[model samples]
Target: MTTSSSPLTHFDGQGQAHMVDVAAKAATHRIAVAQGRIVMMPVTLALILAGNAKKGDVLGVARIAAIMAAKKTSDLIPLCHPLALTRVAIEFVASPEDSAGVASLIDGETGHVSCTATVETVGPTGVEMEALTAVNIALLTIYDMCKAVDRGMTITEVKLLEKHGGKSGSFVNP
Candidate 1:
């Protein structure tokens, strides 16, 4: 785990929010990985897996949304600096069993669809926000596509799993 004693960089001396300046910071290879999961009814998950969603290609469209979200992170986040991302990768995993290999029965027969997004850029600022945003958008896209069938679906545990580069060095969630 990485801990920083430094104060929040987005606030000025007067306590006003502002974007941090990265003009003098050296550009380095930056990578960030984020993950999240959406839980839905087992039947809903089966529908998605069988490519029977009314909106069509739930995972495929979510993948594209994740990539687009990574590229547009700065636009969505006020203090984020626009980055020239080198790569954006998205992965989806649908599992009926939990990590322990036992059926994850929650709220009466549920299934989990996990999204992992890896965003990379060569820039002064880290791409952590971009990666996190990608994961969120991807999960939201899935929810949007399946809401009609599974309105009770929940999106949870969205977070940055790890990040590398910039003056902060590296960080991994413990």
Candidate 2:
């Protein structure tokens, strides 16, 4: 059954559940950051900005949640190798688009709430998935916690912003 990289070691071509062997792979530092956005009404956005979203500390809780989720990526996503994350950071920022002296979003809406998650590790594999997962989980948490205030919230543009320190090298979004 030995073929190419070998049948026992190479599982991608076999279509079976098998953990990748990293014994021969060199260990290197890895880091990745992902970002996303949640759009909602201006009033709803104001409630969050004022720290009165009824859910209490929306960004604070979401940040913590993202960090915790990143640390437990393996448990949440099947097939993901359990990793000891060296560091995980999640951030939230309000992005309001204004055109000169004109109001943005027609009715002066809050535009969007940006959520970013950065993950780092010192291991053989990469942390891109973990970082992206953290951003997703955090955005979902924000939606869940603020649904009562704004049911129309939409999450968009969830992507890896950048990654560095790996055998395959670094990646930056254009």
Candidate 3:
């Protein structure tokens, strides 16, 4: 297990959270992927699928929100270094079951919606936080647009799936 004093290179001497000093680190291409899920009622899912959510196109707005969030990561997250994002992608996949929010795009059943955000950058620091923020904002946008139909919607499974670049090399969830 990684310890607090493992010479991780990002720690402050006092052990309090501190931004990593990347002054000497070489600039490199970096990418990070994050995923999350939102669950809601079948009718709510139908409304979303049919583009009848009343709040306009849910996916279109959510995608824009995610991209904006990725670019404004430092503004939203304190202490996060502002880095130029090379690219960002956020997409939603509806579940395929009647009891779920959306079973399939072709079927009328309601199942869950899965969201994934990938962030890429060529910088000293990684884009993990940007990717995560994009996923979160997308999920939040989904909630905001659909709350009128399903107040009990649940957002879950927000997690980092993979990371590439930086001194640590690469990482992927086992």
Top lDDT hit? 1
Candidate 1 C-alpha lDDT tens digits along 1-174:
344444999876666778998999999999999999998898788787878899999999999999999999999999999999999999998888557544455667689899999999998999999999999999999999999998999999999999999888999998
Q: State each model's CA lDDT, in order.
A: 0.90, 0.81, 0.87
- Worst lDDT run of 10 residues, candidate 3, spans 101-110
State which candidate has the highest TM-score. 1
As for candidate 1, its clashing pairs are none
Off by over 4 Å in 1: 1-6, 97-107
Q: Rank the candidates by TM-score, best first.
A: 1, 3, 2
Each model's TM-score? 0.90, 0.85, 0.87
Clash counts for the predictions, in order: 0, 0, 10
Model 3 per-residue lDDT at 117: 96
Least well predicted 10-residue stretch by lDDT in candidate 1: 97-106
Identify the runs in model 3 with alpha carbons over 4 angstroms from their true place: 1-11, 97-110
- Per-residue CA lDDT of candidate 2, range 1-174, in tens? 333454554365545557777767777989999999998887777676667878798888888889888988889877678888999988887766444412244575456789988899998888888998889888888898899978899999999999998676989999
Looking at model 2, the pairs that clash are: none
> Candidate 1: global Cα-lDDT?
0.90
